[model samples]
Target: MANKKVHTSALLEKAGIPPPESISSSVVNEIQQFRKVQPTSKELVDGILNGNVTALSRAITLIESTNATHVEKANEVINACLPYANKSVRIGITGVPGVGKSTFIEAFGKYLTGLGKKVAVLAVDPSSTISHGSILGDKTRMEELVKDKNAYIRPSASGETLGGVARKTRETITLCEAAGFDTIIIETVGVGQSETAVHSMVDFFLLLKISGAGDELQGIKRGIMEMADAIVINKADGDNIKKANLAKTEFNRALHLFPAKKSGWIPTVSTCSAITKEGIEEVWKTILKFLEVTKENNYFFEKRKVQNLFWMMETINEQLKLNFYNDPEIQKLLDSTKKAVTTDEISPFAAAQLLLKKHFKK
Candidate 1:
């Protein structure tokens, strides 16, 4: 039975972690045991000190957990890993389906490994089924890179609710850093508006595109363009080469339509083909340049610090809401408030205030 205790479970149980009470200890023990033999958080911390891939993946899983009890242990792991994390640049990549995101990642991941840097890929696939799992197949798409001992690939699980990113991803990134990865790449699925969640979390946001004859930008979401640190027109080889060049020129023009970000970082447009491995180095170089410029101007570190603050705020807010609403008495009060609103006895805003006051007092 001791073998069944996952670090997450053991840590949570040890910490008296808060989660849905319905979640059985048996389930926690099962997940914990499975992690024990694999490259787990504990192992990864060891590996990261030595730079191991298996350990990195396990650590990512811990960070991605939605279990409330896991939160504390997750934080502990992140704190322990903090000093080792963040040395690697964090980049967020997104695109619609068929934009060659997985392919490009394989190429990009391979390229970074070739340069003697340790690479960790955390992909948020929102469309995965409840039972089957991540369909993007990071390991298969990047078969070559998967074999490299320096690389770690984690596809998002099927049922995660927080915009495809498992709740603990932000924490996971820290663990990856602690484990000594030099470059952390966050890949988001093709969920249109939801991509912003990833954008707000990463240092650099890259939007991948396909070859469009000047018309694609019109179809692109303004919100995504606004958040992108760079726009990459992929599939630049073969027949699409000409179209890709035109698309790049068009995006360059489109980017000028917007003003600079509050941080004063101007997003750039580039092109690459994962099949040929062309322009991959330039993509990596541009990211470094973006970091260099932002860090020099204090935007890099400040932005991440702000993100951490935001993460804390959101986590606290959600936890408070869960704790409040999950109570039977509070739920009854909320139902009564709604009834009052329908009868015009109390405005919604006032009812909310009253409910909060009552909930806290009780």
Candidate 2:
């Protein structure tokens, strides 16, 4: 037994180790300095106005947070930044899945930055319903723009918002504007109905299309085409250039059939090759012309006022629905009400009325 103990000691010595008698002083110091201090609303506002990207990112995170505790502070930050907002040219871009949206955006954004414009791109990615997660891949796709000092790219999850945008997208735009971005581009998940949501918040709506895609307009909805301020047929390089021109002609003809827009500016159609960076300048010129005409006719400010009113009403409606659904009594009743409806024990309308009454009474 003594020899065995001696052998174990020898092995321990060869293994080269001993327990620490005390924690190192540097480790102790690190532990003492680890407390995180949250920035106040004023600080966040100041940083955003000063064009601090870190502050801008934190402010956006606060705005997007679902926590009730962050609501007051987020509102304070937004209110503080409101005076600096609304100066940027907001544009919305939408297209079907395979239309090379990221490629086009990178090229277009680089062009804007080249013209000494500070550009912000807000790309919304669709979330998986089951996992409630999204693959925010805009940064990966927009490699060149990601490195541009004058460009900022943010990818947000759609989070069950039916319109292919994040719920806080408008607020994000405001923050970007406050951060001195001269141009703001909202990129939506390439799905139908998202176009309407994008159209409501942006001064100009651009629809990106490609050629040799089935019926040329197969997947696009008529309402979306009507909403577009401009439609650009992308991939107009090399062999596909002819096909793109043909698509542009057909689109222009289709657009003429629609009634005149309230803005009094005729919608334009153009073809561009995002890969070769051709015709981008023409597209930007078209946008500038639309802005000039709209501002002259007083439609620019008028549209913004109407949109603000619409958003206010939308917020109220959303809050009311949230309050109704989040009530404990309503949640308990909803489970049974669904079964009752399925079993023919109660009509859907009657169940809804019951739930509403309970919600209001409580």
Candidate 3:
């Protein structure tokens, strides 16, 4: 009975009701500090399960950090939040330069939030670097949506190596879901391999294209088109409407030539004008419909379980590689191995095995 009462009380608190003053001061202080700095694994799990937004954001930052010390903590947080993750729809949006990704995202996000949905935008900006401040200029592009209280926008921080994508994006999605965000939007840097990274983490991949005279299809890469579950031709208003219609037909035809995705979801090509806010809702409806079909077919949970395993394997590989390169003794051997290969004293494969044997004690 006591346990049941406690659970009920916590549920009430999570619903935004203030808990009794008898709640432990230590937990309160921990929550406060978690708001200021990154939380420990336990704190993050507790805070997220309790629907604390600050804790979720801090936990995401912890996972994003390349610092070796945070790896174990990040793993713990992910493991704890695993059950709560994958409940939200994960959508990845990518486009080439000047495609109005930010504008479209804002319009789409605001539309969702207006429908009483909690939306989180995990935006990855590849153009920025540590040496120079993140242009962060795109956030400005989302002029109206930035002011919405229900939307959470996180820009890719400086120095992240995976094409401005925070390595912890998968974990971040978990954190957001645990915080009760119903929809999670991952905005990739929209060039080259970044889209691939985004595609791996999302349930649906959306490729944005600009309609140009005789050159609409010319802008997109074939590989990207193959990966997309939906291709949205943006900037579809005003003078481009005719071109946009033509582009949509072109994309619809192009989609037919490729085999269906492994997910068995047919790619849909549509048009939207971020400027005029046309067709934005239709694009969202398509996303929700896809979710419905996948969920009904049991593909949704299966895919998420596979993605979780992929997350663990990728993290382990990254940590092992980091440890190998960061060890001073290993570095010395690696230098010698490189020299041996350069001088033809050892084959590349033999030199690699030799270094592994020396460092791994195998």
Candidate 4:
């Protein structure tokens, strides 16, 4: 009578009934059939060069993959597409949350496509810091533009600072340009470091503004205002028009306070209603004028060259950090090292040196 044997399996069922495999088998077959054909790097390159959006999307998905196995294939695709890139006009757009960026972009993209410009939009959706999940809803918001044969919209989740917003962005743009998009619109998740990241990747930067929302410049970051090539006051139709105009004037004055841009292009403030499509055309005109001036002064090409250099350096930094963290030995020590620093067992600097020393000892 010392002890009795306990049977946990009896708490449920003696033999669990398996879910119907017959139903799932057909679905699995269909999925396998769909995934059966993954095009080669040369095929993807040829398709992208011929303006194939399917190939372009697949290539971008590969670039975004976190799996190390996909890296080589993604790089091959990017290298193949590079020669056709750097030819498109890169525009970076940013605004605060609830600033109507999606509507404005839809209208602006439609206007661009109407003028026979092949447009590609890389829209970054906000991701949660805790869960790190992103909502890619730009396609739903941009119904008309999504349907246009000449326009392509690819929505990515902003890992905020995990290098998700910046990594592979250049490659995505290159792939889009290779797919013959004359205009590349990079839409940031919101008004933050994402704007700064996107600003570095594009030739022109646009900051979208809204009116009747406290002081016109209250929440605006000075760095963003400075980076903006243009500030567009959105939702300018009807009763909001007057307020929008007033905000535009304030912004124009604020823009003047900053030092002149190196490209010699004065940033302009304009108003537009995405629903009414008013002033959308003018926004394009402003971009065109910016391009004209930058190109004439050779600033555009020079900026591209500088951006290439920045990206090269950024890639090296990211790769080195990734390699360091991904090293088996570092992975083993990272948690304990952090605990040591937090618990006063080791100073932060000393802890970092310890980790680095251990990592580089090879």
Clashing pairs in 3: none
lDDT of 4 by residue, 1-362 (tens): 68988767654744577544556777888978867888888988998999888888888999887668778899999988888888889999888989998999999999998899999999887788789897789999999999999999999887645322546788899899888998999888788643587877899999998999898977688988988899999999999999999998898788778998898999999999999999999999999999999999999999988989998998898778878988999999999989999999999999999999998899
- The per-residue C-alpha lDDT of model 4 at residue 341 equals 90
Q: Each candidate: what lDDT?
A: 0.78, 0.90, 0.80, 0.87
Candidates arranged by lDDT, highest first: 2, 4, 3, 1
Number of the top lDDT candidate:
2
Backbone clashes (count) for model 1: 10
Among residues 3 or more apart in sequence or in different chains, the pairs in candidate 4 whose N, CA or C atoms overlap within 3 Å are none
Residue-by-residue lDDT tens digits, candidate 3, 5-118: 433443343557665788889999997885666556898789888877677777877777667777778878888887876678899888887788899999999999999988
| Model 2: lDDT of residue 61 | 91
Please give the lDDT score for candidate 1. 0.78
Model 1 regions more than 4 Å off = 1-48, 52-55, 127-136, 158-164, 325-359
Candidate 2 clash figure, as a count: 0
Model 3: residue 196 alpha-carbon error in angstroms: 1.3
Quick one: best TM-score, which candidate? 4
TM-scores of the models, in the order given: 0.77, 0.88, 0.80, 0.89
| Candidate 2 segments whose C-alpha is farther than 4 A from its true place | 1-36
